[model samples]
Target chain A: MNCLLCNCQLSMRLCITELFLPIDHQRETVCDACRARFSAYHLSKQCCPGCGHPLNGELLCSECQAWKNNYGQFLHHRPLFHYNEAMAEYMSLYKFQGLYQLRMVFQHVVQMAIKQEEYDLLVPIPVSPTTLRTRGFNQVEGFLEGMQFHQLLTTIDDHKARQSARTRQERLVSQQPFQLNNNVRVTGQHILLVDDVYTTGRTLYHAADLLWQAGCQRVKTLSLAR
Target chain B: MQKTDFYGRRVLLNAEEAQQIRIPNLEIMPAVKKNGDRIYCYRCGQTSSCDTSHLPNNQYYCPVCFNLGRSSSLACYGHLAEPNHFTLPTSILTWSGQLSPLQKRVSQAIDQGMTNHQRQLLWAVTGAGKTEMIFAGIAHALARRERIAIASPRVDVCLELFPRLQAAFANTPIALLHGRTPEPYQYRQLTICTTHQLLRFYHAFDNLIVDEVDSFPYAANQALLFATNNAVKKTGGILFMTATPGRTLEQQIHRHQLHVHYLPLRYHGHLLPQIKINLAPRWRKNMERGLLPLTLIRSIKATLSAQHQCLLFIPHIDDLPLVEQVLYRQLTNSRFTTVYAADPQRIEKVQAMRDGDYDFLITTSILERGVTFPEIDVYVLGADDSVFSSSALVQIAGRAGRAVTRPTGRVIFWVSALSRSVNDARRQISLMNRKGRCLQRELSSL
Candidate 1:
């Protein structure tokens, strides 16, 4: 089967993207694509196992994640696929198009794009109840349909963008960030942050920023489509 | 928005979601109220807004969500590449345009694999013209805008292959990547590279081919296999072309587990080239004192009379120059060139021979691999050369008969001593020839 995530074949075990599919390639278990996309991809290695970064071999953005103690851990929120016009169109029918059945494909491609990683938990990015009622579901939550689920952390606070409108330079200058639920704590745990479409990557950046602040060992992001 | 205009295919999910995503199929996450904090778990429908909650360490769903599970199985290279992109073509090597048994079987396998998008392995023998068989599949994938990469061990082989493939599909954007070439800047659909160069790519091409699959660099290193996997695009086609498949591959093929092709003969009604052993051990060792090896000296003169350029392979650089000097001395006015390691003039010398600058060329193992001349009589002084690998010797001999005049040559191996390698080379040549003839007969019958 074509993994919606990494687009790798679905032969063996279920990759992270497999959870969204109805029938996998082998027609036995899930596939590797989904597992890779949703698994704790960021925590797979010590960031030291290889001379290069541990997050993703393709994006060797983190050369020093191991030595640095804590500065909002991710090297850079560099999403794998290009969220171009074509991808955006796929997302329109996929993200906002209300074709919920398409979530399985998202999982497949994402899984194909990424591979297996070691992480503490797969945390679906949380949304507000009011927002969920209007949208009918948390975008990422829909991907976890057939996946094993968890209740690790809550999305208690709605983070704000640093500024309303600004040039690229201005936005880079403003730098306001996401705030998580302080009542709950997630310290020194590998965090695989699941989301839907990776548009600006700012939202995932803000969310992961909150995660690292809580002392999480690592934070990674995966979306149905990018 | 796909510029060329692709219809929006609203792709659907398969069974993976039910198995790997979440078994029970609850796409909606329930909000819960925990100590005044609102949280949710998509699996159990438990949220901070709900009354019940589970501990963080409690085993509820699979590990990915909780980040506490295994891959469930070891993922192989076939899974990383697209299965549907592989299509072995029925070879049209000679003008008759008939697919050999090996070509037919391999093409069927690749076609099947590409259509199903599944991983597969294809095994065959040397001189099988395995490259020609995959051209149809590769061309198809390229037409579809899918990416492809054909990789092998030696650059010389790439030198021979690239031109042939380029001719097959005119005016396509093809890239031959190595340390010298720049990486594709926004546009490189099909590529060729040495395995060492593969480490530079990561999930890029849609179809991956490891030519001479049993050859070094690719077979000896697990990391190379990993690198090939990394360079290929997700769900791409993977094809391995090899002659002497290792025991592991042989077992798979014997069990009918791998996709296989077996083209044993040369195209165009040509017979497998012939080999001859020159029993001149004593003559070679004692010829150092300004004396010419009678057997070699005679063969060279007779070969010249036949209007054939001769390739005399001596094991050492010292002997190559010595042979050139001796041949010059023996024939008085005859012209000859020597090509060996560190011969800064190697290319000039090779070109000189090609341009017919000299009637003979004495070379080292450098010419033992690629670069074929149609009608060359080849002689190996140290056919027992440890430096001469089995594949290398076979290929050097293959350079003979490349010209239609004599679809073969007088391959004389002058050995000071007999070694296992010499026997191996002889055995290999014989077996390959027999297989080639057998296949040719079969192909003709068909």
Candidate 2:
């Protein structure tokens, strides 16, 4: 097998348990060198509880403070990795270039992270109909393969620019682009929202705000990158 | 959106650009075609078993050539027939440089091959003015209104060849294409591009000259070979120029399947420098202990004392830091730097070496080909390592004694255990030198 990212030949040695066990597990899709490029977030570090951004001994970041003032409640988001250069390159290939095979690089990590969170419904952020048509598969859904997730939200048909193209101020002031799907039960239920990346906290906030209006008891969010 | 952009090229267009292509003569086809259980990419010409590169809704994208652009079943490619729209110029050859008599002979053979549309190979030694020898052939093809392209496997070779080609074909419009080039593609009679960029072309060139055909990533890559075959017209000619032809090309020559031209001597009619092998065991262990072999250090000191630069070719990049430290400790007064493929300042470092700024350089095989440093000696510290192919070793040895003023220099290989590649490299150099000696005698008598 070869790494999905670097295309180097992989020689995976079989462990004792793997050699004896009859059950087949998913093989590694990336080499150790390529995998080492992505760094996981340090949860022990002082960070904002609202958005998980690194903080210098502060209660909340300015963006999360604004979120708390507007909605009377802020989302508690757990991000897996930092949005460093390697992560940015990974996003460009996996999302922009649409290399479907690259989803395997981080699928297991995202799955394992999602498993740690407790929620009644795992709701993945939805792509617009146009994006669904063009990009084929929803990027957030690509990371959630073989797992149970609810597509409770659907994006509104707004032909606006992509979030990545917008500046920070523009992304912060952008209006909500998501709505709850028809006839979804969310009253008094704990909801967990999933997204591929949490850039300025606007996208996840929009989805969380809709779920809050739908009378969910509590809402939490998780993303692959901050 | 110009019609000329799609002429003789298979271009992937987005939704916005696809709508603007209003040309009626253009042929449109799916970027990828799906068979029973496999999907074939039209651009790279590779078929995969639909297990890994699949998408939703029975769609698939090619993973092989995804770096150029994603070619999927959902995308379509536009190909306009090659118009060959070139205006015949009054004077196509602007190069005033003189070629040696032997070089002139090889140049005529290349011109004949291009005229007859036959596949040929030019087996020239290093520093034989191979680029100058091809000017007449390219000029002839341009005069006949036939499109020509010069491609190489390495981007460095393409970049170096582009300016020389521009100076040679002064009036002809030449386009330089590569992965990182910011300029958009244009319809030019002549083009200089890397081999990877040839995937975007379809029967585009009447004559394609591939320099350094035995170099890496193109020497044995099936997809690139397929691209070369697909990029040329059915009746077009191909001329592969290389100092060290690989086993496949050698077999082709042996079978009389390929027309061959040999320029065994250098432009100055001098023979190649022979390689001397010295066994140096535990060199890597000693390097880790901050020490170099006595023989290797003596050779470096000798070259430096003689006021000549030397290149120390290591087997791997991982050993560069250790070797650099050892060299600094041993030769404290001399100035040097180490370079590898990923070094951001590799080009600048090579330029500095050419300017006589450094006494010696520790480098990997990245500088083994397509570079020249005058009045320099060459040494391979780990010549028996698996990384040093026979061709690579020969290229490294060729780096020395290239200038006319310094027709001879030292070439040494410090090997722990002599291997077949090392032996083969030494034997090949001797054989070339023998042939070059015979050529020299004949020319002197004449």
Candidate 1 versus the native: TM-score?
A: 0.47
Q: Write the per-residue lDDT of candidate 1 for residues A125-144, one digit (tens) a residue.
A: 66654344333445566556
For candidate 1, the C-alpha RMSD (Å) to the true structure equals 18.6
Q: Please, what are the lDDT tens digits per residue for candidate 1 over residues B360-421?
A: 88888878655666778888886776666555666667667766566767777777677766
Q: Ten residues in a row with the worst lDDT in model 2 chain B?
A: B13-22
- Which regions of candidate 2 fall more than 4 Å away from where they truly are? A13-15, A22-26, A158-160, B14-20, B35-37, B285-294, B301-308, B324-337, B342-359
| Superposition error at A182 for model 2 (Å) | 0.8
Clashing pairs in 2: none
**lDDT by residue (tens digit), candidate 2, B1-446:** 78898888899975546777788888887788888888899888898878888997888888888888889877788998788988877889999998877989889999999999888999899878899999999998898889899999989899989999899888987899999999889899999999999999998999999999989889888789899988999888889999988778878988987899888887777788899999989888878888888999999999999999999999999999899988888898999999999999999999999998988899999999878998899999989999888889999999988999998889999999999989888887887887878888898899
lDDT of 2 by residue, A1-226 (tens): 8988888999877889988999697788989998899899877558899877789978988889999999998999999999898899999999888888888988999999988889999999888887766677889998998899999988888733589989999998998898788787999999989999899889999899998988999999999999
Candidate 2 CAPRI level: medium
TM per candidate, chain B: 0.65, 0.91
TM-score of chain A of 1: 0.55
Worst 10 residues of 1 chain B by lDDT: B68-77
